[model samples]
Target: MRITGYRALNTVQEWGRAVGDANGVYADGLTEVPMVLVTTDEGITGVGMGPHVELDAVFAAIDGEDPRGVTALYDRMLRQMFKAGHAGTVFGTIGAFDTALWDIKAKAAGEPLWRLLGGRDRVVPAYASGLDIDLDDEDLIRTYQQYAEHGLRTAKLKGGLDVERDRHRLSLVRDVLTEAGGGARPGLMLDANECWSRKQAVRHVAELERTLDLIWVEEPVRRWDAEGLAAVGRGVRAAVASGENLSGLEQFRPLLAAGALDIVQTASVWGITHFLRVAALAHGHDLPVSPIGTNPVGLLHAAASVPNHLASELQVLQPPVGVALDLRIEDGAFVLGDSPGLGVVLDEELIGACELQPATSSFDGPGVRPERAGHRLLAAAG
Candidate 1:
């Protein structure tokens, strides 16, 4: 069926507790979730979740094209932004449309997205990520206890501010997961969110490694610093995982060629096509690929088809307000239902009824880099 038009809206995810990393924290734990609905001539509408920048310009490229030809249309959307450059928020816009088109293609085929993507298994392994830098010790225990109840033997904590505090928090989470696993050795990970310098990353992770057997350390240095990342990887026993902030495959080429990243990662908001391509690239390098996002169900379908999917980050247990998915997290994995397409159903009325918070400044927010992030090294030296 030919594409007709699209509609965009916003919803919020109430995280129940303050969520942040080394960058910052939202005290209210509320964040915006933008959505796009692409409608076709045949009355089928596909849903995609991401930012809403340059939607009109990006959507114009595939206005009358067949939604089933998703791959070609993805390239078309990228070319539409060739002169303007398709990085940052614009890339997310393209990804939103690309995922919606894939949703439509799978729905038209009358099959679940996993089956349409040739995934053999419906279950995708998962690891809990709480974004819990602002959470207190009691809240931290309570947070991981919930994930432990879900049978998640692996968890990633948000840290890199203070080594001693991070070590204490990591121990708490590990104990909880290990108990949940009946004394099985639990896998633990840390996300510094690119707050540390190369030396700081190596030093901080080396300190934590003395006690915690970490599975990986994510974004220890900046997203584009291939040499710094390689240095951190060389110094630390745990693997280095990054690339969620990177926009395209070309950006990953240097990191791959330099043998920098041990575990490659891509954000779910980057779309299925991008994740699939990144996965293929990582596979060629003999490295494992993981996905990072709040709701990564769409990528999980694609992840199921990839041979090198290590694990997906499970940020929140529930879907965003007024949205539902045809999937469930069971026994430390996400099990996809037989719902066609992305299995996302939205209640626009409910979303509209919900109160909207004031927009956060670009310079602030959990994922944004803090002003004095790496400067702490100077204080420590003094």
Candidate 2:
């Protein structure tokens, strides 16, 4: 089978709570458009989510393609295009298409992607991610309490602003867990979102080292600061975790080799196939992997396919509008579905009915911006 056509859908929704990460303050919520890539052969179609691509250009690039040569086709697009910007939203868009191609291949073969990945017992553990940073002490505790009741084993808190405020919040969460019992004290992790400099990261995180009992402190310094990240990893009481911004196995070699990062996180932008490749490279060095989310579909597939991954990141609060694609999340772990490839499907009627729209231009804002191409490639391979 070959890809006969492709399409893009960009949707925006008002986030219930403003989310702050190493990226910046998402004050008015976020406008995230989930691009869909459609591949058809004999009219049977497979769909994947490509984020921001000049979708028109993407269609022209891969309109007529071999369904089997998914990897080669992906490389062809990368090699041919002068990918602008650091992470290449366009290439990331390509990732969506590559995913669609894989779905088609798996469906044709009558097996799931996990089976292809050296099949293990399905269903991997999940942790609640995309938690709001601005919640008050009371609300934060309530949130953790709720997750604990739901059978979640772990939770990640967003950190990186006021040291005192963060400390207070962590203390509250710890206290709630202690008080609530019923394994309310799930494993805790922290993500700084690269909001601090090397020096600041060291000082601020040191304060929580003894108190929080963090499973890992993610992106405390910055994405490309090898020396700085190494310093934070060495100095902190918690294990230092990073690499969600990273792509390609070669680029991740150095961070793994240097032992600068404790957990090597990969995102869906690399697609599930490459995700495992990077995971294996990290595993070779005895490093664990934690893949990021693009909603239930990608998260479930990655959790199923990659055995070495620590936990799949789930956005409990997805944007308020647009399509509702739900995967079961009980007790902090994602429940996988038996329905064919990726198992989850987008409601097109819901997509059309929803008012969420994509941003007209790229969001240029404060905090650490996306990296440059050369720098990212170097960081990945360093």
Runs of candidate 1 exceeding 4 Å displacement: 356-363, 378-382
lDDT of candidate 1 vs native? 0.90
lDDT of model 1, residue 351: 92
Error of 2 at 129 (Å): 2.0
Query: What is candidate 1's lDDT per residue for 284-375, written digit by digit as tens?
Result: 99999999999887899899899999999999999999999999989999999999998999988899999957356434787576678776
The estimated TM-scores of all candidates read 0.97, 0.86
lDDT: worst 10-residue window of model 1:
373-382
C-alpha root-mean-square deviation, each candidate: 1.6, 5.4
